[model samples]
Target chain A: MSAPAQELPRPGGFPEIKYKRNIPKVGPSGLTLLVGITALCTFGLYRTGQGNLERRELEREKVWARIHLVPMLQAEADRDTYRREVADKAREAEIMKDVKGWKVGESVYNSDRYQPKTYAVVP
Target chain B: MSTYREPTLPTGKFVDPTPAPAESAHPEVGATSAPLKSAAYFIGAHCKEYNEDFMLCKNENADPAHCLKEGRKVTRCAMDLITKLRENCEKEWVAHYQCLEKNNQEYYACRKPERTLNECVFSKIKLEKVIPGASGTPIHLRTDSIYS
Candidate 1:
């Protein structure tokens, strides 16, 4: 009446298992879709960033928009107020450099002690 | 032309990046780079902490100089720090502005902290504290002190 319940495999189990194995285990590749989505998102971020940057720039211009037009005009009227306040020695130094024809954009980058230095970290 | 990359140095062949051989593999005890030892660096590093005590981030870099919005206690401290930065920036401008001629290299200059008040013991004393206006105290009272 029972060869044994455990031994009763009336279904086609062996072939089914082989068939499953024969089919690749990997899912459909989404490389193209992933690339497309990433590209679109990156472009959108860049576009949004452009507008945000513009807004920030405009805001910077508007801030202090009415802060002190009169005071600023008065300060400008004094013209050489900042220049005159400085000692004659300082003025001479500036003039001397100009007379010597030192170009502002010249290689004075090396002469400035405060010039930033490059750092190389040890491995 | 072969684009040469420095191959990983093996063992004894390790090349030190320093121009001159370092006196020691490690910087001497208590040694700090001069750039890392500036007051601006110190303040920038502790900005958030200091701002908590002093109203900072009151405005991002968008605000004009000297237009301090007076309200937050932390803002006062931040303004003090910003004032110092602007004053001493001429010395720092060359390095901070010059060295990295390309890209956002200038920002790297603003990233150091050397003048920290590590040893100072700070205590909060609330004076003329503005208690939130309750229904009973409809009018805001300005006491002689801002301390709460």
Candidate 2:
């Protein structure tokens, strides 16, 4: 029997397929920069939230002032006028305490106490 | 293998990206360094109740004249308390007024029931009545002997 013919090798062979692994790398400085950025962003968000809260609170206060404080101030003015009136009446009473015999038109008018305080308004 | 590249900031382009602190954070700015203690604080705290009354009146669409009566009572009562506070807590009141003159924000910020003002007033000013509920009827319609 003739010797088996040797298997012939292919002429132009295809390049062998090769797989390469690539690992991601981050340095110490890169990690520090990332942490800093995240912290700063978090702080910024917190401050913005705080500012918004305060602004809303301030607006509420302004509205309360407009609705309540203004009218209350006016009422306070009226109360002040009443207080002055009461003071004047008290002063008049204290001044006339020593007077004994007094007539409504004659003797009452003659006394210095009945002459009215210099600052008092004449009706 | 690739070598790590350092990030470079351009000259004259490096800027601070942080926000400034709030005014409340800096107490040393002005008169804000000191706490407030004033007559208005005590009375204002009490006025909250009266304000609720006023709001209720408004909600009911009550007459302005009637609503004003309630407001008048609150104002009068507050003024009376203020007089007492001035006489009793003179030192605190004076300090607070000075703070107000120096800085309005500090003054306004101090107007709280929990502030030193309330402490001063509550300890010093003695009062028979706290909140005068409501002033009923108009001034002209009152047939009280005191009016006559």
Candidate 3:
């Protein structure tokens, strides 16, 4: 009756309809991300293994060297001493030859190559 | 406590103008050469036993003349090795031989550039400084002298 009652749209007219489209069903790139992470972990693991192998080889070589060092050093020392003694002997022999006026390699003192000259003692 | 002062008054023929030569000045006493014993020991491959025997003879007061056999044995052994060394190290041998034959000098000249002959001999021979009392020691002496 109030001016044909301007039909005041019912307060909740359109049945409260709301539109939604399955949220586009978005999922992370799970397979690609998983592969990338797995590859990175594997590379890191391989590098660590390689370093360990090299370290072990070096350790083995050092141990072997330590084991044989003493004998090698001793042999070198003996050879050096022998060489020195022989050189000294050669020098002494040369001096003896000079004093006696004997030919080189002559063994007059202990051999029959020559004899010492003797003179009468003066009283 | 007082410094002592000695009296000096005698001045009658204190010094001899013509001093007599000391016996040690004789050439034989002063004769120097590469010691025969060491030469025999080092140059030879296996003459330690012979060297020991020679030393024993000397220690017993045997005349040096009596030791000639052992001495010759040692030299012969060394000479044998030296000959082999010449064959083994021909290059070094030529240099050493030329020095001795032409220059009339010892083989030591070859050692100036490098110890070629020495290196060869040492490789082929065993050098022992002392004769061990223990038996069963190896002896590598050859019987005949190459030079002779």
Which of the predicted structures, 1 or 3, would earn the higher lDDT when compared with the native? Answer: 3
What is every candidate's C-alpha DockQ against the true complex, given to 2 decimals? 0.01, 0.04, 0.02
Name the regions of candidate 2 deviating beyond 4 angstroms: A1-28, A54-71, A76-123, B1-41, B47-72, B106-114, B126-148
For the predicted complex of model 1, DockQ is 0.01
Interface RMSD of 2: 23.0
TM-scores of the candidates in the order shown = 0.18, 0.39, 0.27
Q: Which fraction of the native contacts appears in each prediction?
A: 0.00, 0.12, 0.00
Which candidate, 1 or 2, has the higher TM-score? 2
Candidate 2 residue lDDT tens string, A3-119? 998976567776666677666775568779999999999999987786565455444443433444443454443334334444455545555556676322232344433232244
Best DockQ among the predictions, by candidate number: 2
Computed on alpha carbons, the lDDT of every model, listed in order, comes to 0.32, 0.46, 0.40
The Cα error of candidate 3 at residue B112, in Å, is 5.1
| Top candidate (TM-score) | 2
lDDT tens string, model 1, B14-128?
Answer: 3433231121111111212222222223333334354332223323331222122222223334345445444544344334333324323322222221001221101111112
lDDT of 3 by residue, B72-129 (tens): 4544454554455446655654554454444333322223312454465466554332
For all candidates, the clash counts are 21, 0, 13
User: On residues B1-148, what C-alpha lDDT tens digit does candidate 2 reach at each position?
Assistant: 1135455544563222322222111111011212222333344555667756765764564333335556556665655555566578667666666665555533334343223544666666632112122234322123331211
Q: What is the lDDT, from 0 to 100, of the residue B107 in candidate 1?
A: 26
Which parts of model 3 are misplaced by more than 4 Å?
A1-123, B1-41, B44-46, B96-112, B124-148
Where model 1 places Cα greater than 4 Å from the true spot, the runs are A1-31, A34-40, A43-123, B1-109, B113-148
